[model samples]
Target chain A: MTTAEVSAPTTEKPKRDKPMGTETRVAWTFIAPGAALLLLFIVAPFVLAIWFSLTNQRLISPLPTRFVGFENYLGELADPLFWKSLWNNFRFAAFVVPAQTAFALLLAVFVNQRIAGRVIFRTIYFTPITVVMAAAATIWVLLFNVNGLVNGFFELITFGNFAPDWLNDPTWAMWAIIVVSIWQGVGFQMVILLAALQDVPGELYEAASIDGAGAWKQFTNITVPGIRNALIFVFTVTTILAMRLFDQPTLMPRSPGGPLDSTRTTMVHMVDLGFGRQAIGRGSAIAVIFFVIVLILTLIQRRFLKEESAQ
Target chain B: MTADSDVRVSAKKSVGANPLWRWVLYSVMIVLAAFFLFPLVYMVASSLIPDDQVLAKSQSFEAFVPTPFVGLENFSDAIERANLPRVFANSVIISGLIVSLGLVVNSLFGYALARLRFPGRKLLVGVVVALIIIPFEALAVPLLFMGAQVGWLDTYQIQILPFIASPLFIFLFYTFFLSIPRSLEEAAMIDGASPVEIFTRVVAPLAKPAYATVAILGFLFSWGQFLWPSIVTRGVDVRPLPVGIGVFATTPPVSWGDIMAYTVLMTLPLLVIFLIFQRQFVQGVASSGVKG
Candidate 1:
């Protein structure tokens, strides 16, 4: 039997009844602008990028470019800088993915309780999501300065002189960027998790309480299990964001990576190679590699989330 | 009977007694909330002070000082230095155009995916989802070349056109359309309504909330767009506020005070939008299963 025979008629329809005459033409007319824009901007650019990746084309040189086949890819594959930046991006993802998930989940549970001034707290927590990237980075640059607010606060608390310039020092630059990312990101994930928490049934919590479970036990066994779907969602999204880390380090007047190229993320490297240096072929190769990596990770995450939801 | 009553009374008493752990939990939550809010508060407070006293180390309570205040001096300076009035106008026009155009395209595509049976529907949806993961930087170089070739460079078409059919918005609207009851549209069809009529009269009215959700998200993304406009525009004439502020912030004299003021200026419109639509943004965020 064909697949169509087994499906309901509603699901098995294969054609649209063309609303005849001028209306049908008009409908297409309405869609023409969008269709044209998508073709010109999205589809055309994607195809062009693929073609450019296979040729040695520089943005500055207007001469006819020669097709190099896979040479660009080969060059990127052998470059040590590519490997180092790729490794750094993965490391950043590893730290951010787990830490952000745990922090967002914990904060969601804390705020889930029916406490006084709940709305106010929610607003306060989610305010950072609205902040522009430039502004946020500026504030962070000041705070992470040796004599700025964060270090000054640390000294006050410890009663010892301990101040390291966060964006300047190689040892701390990546971590510093990661910290800013988390501060910017935590609120968004928190809101998502909180929504998930609200959606979970309250009877399960009441039953756990009646069974003489402590707060910690209830949270670990009941709350965690209940919001597993949300936890997976947060992990996948944050992984994507962390892999695309660019603006903070890019805005710094120092090296794109800052302090011995410690903060050079893969995306930043690709941008510099393509736009700044005008090596389109090499940059396209990097983008393709980066795209492949993200694809594999997203597939893995989707599979994990699917399996968890199946339970 | 007396023994049963006493047992019930004891049960009620135990239920009424709040746990000590809950108190500590509330206190911890409050502290966490305060900690997260501190930076935003500090940013706003610092922007209110005169440029002379901004980083002075003399006044210990400088950020919190309400007296001897300079009102909107930083705002005026930031506006003057950054040419923010022009940037704000540009941002508003770009965001408005994108959102308006995006709504039309997404609605049509969403309806096609949801109700109309067409060839390659599943394939199209899959492509949209896959497009979500392709980072914007991947296409930046070719997109720039395309813009140059088409004479769209430094134009509104460059800023607004590419963003019109966001995969995220298409996915969002598609899901929303699927959830609407088919019977309503079916009835409309039976009553001699065309697909367009049914959509405009029935589905569109019912889908207001979803449209609002997409509109806000689209507007916010366009407003905060820096990387694309930064490369494409190349000057202050067509730059959005985020990139405009970014360029101005990097310019000489390095006034943290003016930067803060400009930051506040850029942030104020968004804050106002959020305040006015607080419930919608919150509800929209909750209903949409995706994170920013």
Candidate 2:
């Protein structure tokens, strides 16, 4: 059956009242600006990048460009640094995604309660979300200083015997980046999860409590199950963010890469290739490959993390 | 339900629970809250200090407090050195242009899909969904090359055009329009209004909140951009505040106090907008389902 017959004489009829020619023309006219901009920005750039990835487009040159199909990919494949940087991205994602999720969920749960100063608490947690990464990076450098608040916390608990230069120490730098990433990142995810958590029925918790369930049990069995979609959404977004791994690492250190190239992410590497070293073709190749990896990672995450089981 | 109502239930339940437990929860929450607030506190504190005492050992209990108060020299100096006013002007212009143009393109596309029927409508919706996942990082390189090819480098259009429409923004409008009743538009049409007139006068007026959400979102995006502008802008001439700050922070003779002042200056307007429209901001983020 046609759409008109199947869905006859409702609000849908008004839209179909016009002749096909007029409707189509109106649709095109309405869509023209967005379509044109999308084409110019998204589609054309995507096609251009694919073509550039196949060729040798030096950032600067008297040298003419040539199509070196698969050469760039092969070179990237053989480069150990490429692998290391990609692994760095993976390491970042692995650490950040779960940590961010757990902390965000905790914050959301806490603020979701009947508590004094809940608005104040909510705003405090969310305040960091307002911070620009550049400002965040600058602020964090002091926090990691030997005599900074990190060590201040240490002194309050211990003797402050071991204060390390966080951004400069290769051993501590990645951890430092992870710390900063979580702090700035968690607030946003918390807000999302909070919005989801609010949608869940409070009566379920009350009923579970009446059945002699503890808070932990209720959280695990009820709250977790209730906000399962939001959990996936938060987790997926966090993972994708980790894969990108740009601004936090870029800004956290005395320089862009952190100490001893320990925090040099795939994004930094891409920037180094495209802008720093002026090898546009190699960078384009990296970007495409990076996109594929993210796509694959997202698929794997969805397969494993989907809420189908919850249903 | 709000926390007030939730808390009432918990308070009743806690009548039989331990009294100390509630105190402990509040303490932990307060400490963690302070931890999250530290950087913002530190930025403002540092900015209020004299340049000499900014990074120096002070007589205060904490590292953030300075011994002497500086009378906004840092703010003045930072503005002069970074030419922050000019960069702020650039940011305002860029964000303004992006929001104004973005609303036009995205809203039109949304109105078409939500209200009009044509061939390829489903396919176009699919395209938007697919495009939404294409992160700007992945597209950065090719876009840069395209910018160079088209001689758009160091131009305002380079910053403005690439961000004029996004699938998420279109979806936001599309969803909003779908929620709007169709009979209103039909009545408008029967009153001899054109379809375009129905959209602008009839539909768009009712969609003011949607426009505000998109506008605030669009403004935040264009203003807060760092990496893209870093790539595309050639130098001080076209660089917005964040990019200019990124570059400035890297260069030598970087004064901590001045940097903090710049941070405060750059951050306050956004913070104010956020505070004033926190509800709309939350709606924007939730509806778009993207990170800030």
Candidate 3:
């Protein structure tokens, strides 16, 4: 698929300007269905979200809706639980972005080697990515049980000194979710980085070694720079994913964002308010805020990374 | 050393030529592999055991081994209790529609963007690129409100329609269509073939990899959909497997074995497909990741 296709000769050259009318009509006809759907689904919802945030809209309400400019936003800003959920989102991203990226890069480098059974190893590591997050969370909820295999292994290794109730414990709930997120997501980054690693010319490594460079030196100088763009890409994508932490926390915990609201991410909070509490206005407010944060982070990362790459 | 010797040294280093280092590398890979495989292996094993014995055996190495196997008892129980058949059919219909229709719609738009000289072509492409940055979660709340307002709640189309015109997939298709040579289309055009004929007979045949990549990824995305379906479908009539499994796992009188069985059942088809199309799966992910 990557190889360039050979161009074939034509029997006759069609006048491009003459077919402009027909070509434009055909193009619009082709694009119409998808463009209309995008307009109805994505664009319309986005606009409604902003409008809903401004007004006091309820999912099912008796009173007529009225404009309540900035009230929902102000309420959310004043709510400690809202701040907690936002903090939890940031905290999850902080741990996952670095940990998953590093681990994935490590796995990618290892599997990139010319080792026997590397394909099998790659497949094994990547199996989690295929499993649905709900299934992964369900399986992991059992594993993270007090007397489950995870604690059992930890007890065996630590001589029974430590075994926390992962999901129920407020302190450990987010951490458990983080572990699952990293486990399920690292394989994706690994595959991407592995592809990037393969693209790094072997000649550079050979040249570096000729200058008496060690493996670590060659890795730091040649390998890292070679895959710099991929590293940034992985970092940014992982952060965005971490910010959307919902399925695991919702499914794993006793309740969605249980244990003192410790695992209440922004998305979870939005859902709880919007659907569960039937506070559509507040939920839309949170959604707008969440969207802005994601947009700003993505834009900042793009600019920052582009500058770094330039340097 | 000579240039040839340097190449040999690097080649040897790439594979860990030293015996002890290679042994260490193998050991690490094996341990990591085991770590990655343990939860899945345990899930399968627990699914086969009886409910009472599932958690009991999880405390030790025996958890990895399915003893006192009850065969398909848990599977039968889970299917009956969770209404797995209905949910499974629902998931199949939903994902199938999304994948098939999505391919046609998104690929057509992509092809138009790549090949057609429409008036608003550049503007449409820019809009798609801009739309790619909007996370779906950010829109879920408002979409739910919109869905409720339009009386679209508790329907299969609500789950399937919004996702059919994905910006990311559209962009992926756009870039892929751009990459292929257009000479064949031109040749076909010279033969008095219309644009649609040229697209179907000449261009579509050559874009199999792009289609396969989009189809596999699209199916996986739709099949695993949780958030949208959760809010939209309040009943089991149209709920997909991911949401079904989530609800099943959380329902009262939770049985570990039954839940594992259900999970295994929910995951089995995708696992089989992934194993069969491992190359395409990896390629799909890598290409999407690198291109994005």
Top-TM-score candidate index: 3
Per-residue lDDT of model 3, residues A1-311, tens digit only:
11111111111114456687788899999999999999998999899999999999999999999999999999999999999999998999988899999999999989887778989999999989888989889889999999899899999999999899999999999998988888888999999999998877777877787798988898899989998888888998899888888898788899998888999999899999999999999999998998998898789778867787689
Minimal lDDT window, size 10, model 3 chain B: B245-254
lDDT of each candidate versus the true structure: 0.75, 0.80, 0.88
CAPRI quality band, candidate 3:
medium
Please report the candidate that would top lDDT against the real structure: 3
Give one digit per residue, the lDDT tens place, for model 1 in A60-157.
Answer: 68688999999989998888878878887888989988998888887776666555676777777777777777677777775676666777677777
Ranking by DockQ: 3, 2, 1
Best-to-worst lDDT order: 3, 2, 1
**Residue by residue across B98-141, what tens digits does model 1's lDDT show?**
99989989887777666665434566666667777776777788
Give a tens-digit lDDT track for model 2, residues B158-254: 9988999898889888888999888999899789887788888999999998899899778866787878998889778888888777645555555
- For candidate 1 chain B, which ten residues in a row score worst on lDDT? B7-16
Q: What lDDT tens digits, residue by residue, belong to model 2 across residues A14-71?
A: 6556566677788899999999999988888888778888999986689899999999
Worst 10 residues of 2 chain B by lDDT: B58-67
Candidate 2 clashing pairs, residues 3+ apart or interchain: A114-B7
Return the clash pairs for model 1, or none. none
The per-residue C-alpha lDDT of model 3 at residue B185 equals 88
